[model samples]
Target: MIPPEVPLDDEELVTRAQAGDLEAYELLVARHTASAYRTAILLGAGADAEDMVQEAFVKGYRKLSRYRGDASFRSWLLAIVANETRNLHRSRDRRTGLVLRAARAAPYSEAAEDGAVDAALAGERRATLVQALRSLPERDREVIVCRYFLDLSEDETVAMLGWARGTVKSRTSRALVKLRGLLDVEELSRG
Candidate 1:
């Protein structure tokens, strides 16, 4: 049995999965699950992220026959996860709020060097940014999250959002401007 970490390329796993190799499919899921969850979370799926990721994997498995070899398997799987997250968002009527998990602090020595005041300031800044992000329209938020938070390439964003490349670029530019405005307003209100 080949070890899961043997670095079999996604294309190979996908081919095996297409041949009804369950372990190959499982490996694909294991590889992409974290990223899928993060994308769901950034899209505001909240507690439903886990379910969304699971559903995406199941759906992806069922639809493996339709998956062309053109796109990377991870991108294709993520597009399905994005769609699942969007569907859940629509059905739930956007009930859950966005939760921004704070970054883990550095080692104790490094954290001590940074000091309590700096950490508090950083936390407050992060909170403000999260609030601003939550205030944007869902479409804008989705573009911003895909482009920035998820760090997806333009092509990947296009695939995930089912938008044209030009559309992705335009939306990302517009969303950034809107986000900046929101953050500015927040700063002004604080002052």
Candidate 2:
């Protein structure tokens, strides 16, 4: 009996992609799209996460020759995703707030119903939280996303962020405090 074909590692796929193999590049995209999309959303792309991820993958493909492989391909791709998200924010002149798309679309009842009010309040809360999260320094935001938003364990967070375990611990602690302060300030100012 014939054995099933094994999937190639990202390194091999990337190497093949860099050599102009479109299929290999597609494989890479298929493998990492979820991670890319999540990174885009957590990094403030929000409702535009899908678009940002698509753009990031295209850019990653075009720039594959420049990838040095110093980091794992996933890490490298995530950095591209992050840059794409930042570019999206800049392109919007940073004036618009991110809408968590699901929250905005979840209200189903008539406008006069209690469901509408609940949905509106939920959306406002999510937007305020996202804004507070966006106010954090980049490192803090990344740590928070990896830990709380993405719910990655400490070990996974350490691997994903390329930080030491102790660094992850301290940063997560510090970032949470800052986020709380920002949310508190937002609440106080709104009154």
Best by TM-score: 1
Estimate, for each residue in 1-191, the C-alpha lDDT of model 2 and write its tens digit: 99999999988999899988999999999999988887777666877889988998988888899988866788778777877877887898854333244334334334435676776776677778877876777888788877776666787677667789899999999999998999999999999
* Alpha-carbon RMSD of each model: 3.8, 5.3
| Candidate 1 global CA lDDT score | 0.80
TM-score of each: 0.86, 0.67
Tens-digit per-residue lDDT, 89-166, candidate 1: 679775443435312211223444487987777677777887887787777877888888788888888878888889
Evaluated at residue 46, the lDDT of candidate 2 is: 72
Worst 10 residues of 1 by lDDT: 101-110
Candidate 1 has a TM-score of 0.86
Q: Can you tell me which runs of candidate 2 are displaced by over 4 Å?
A: 95-139, 151-170, 180-191
- The model with the greatest lDDT is 1
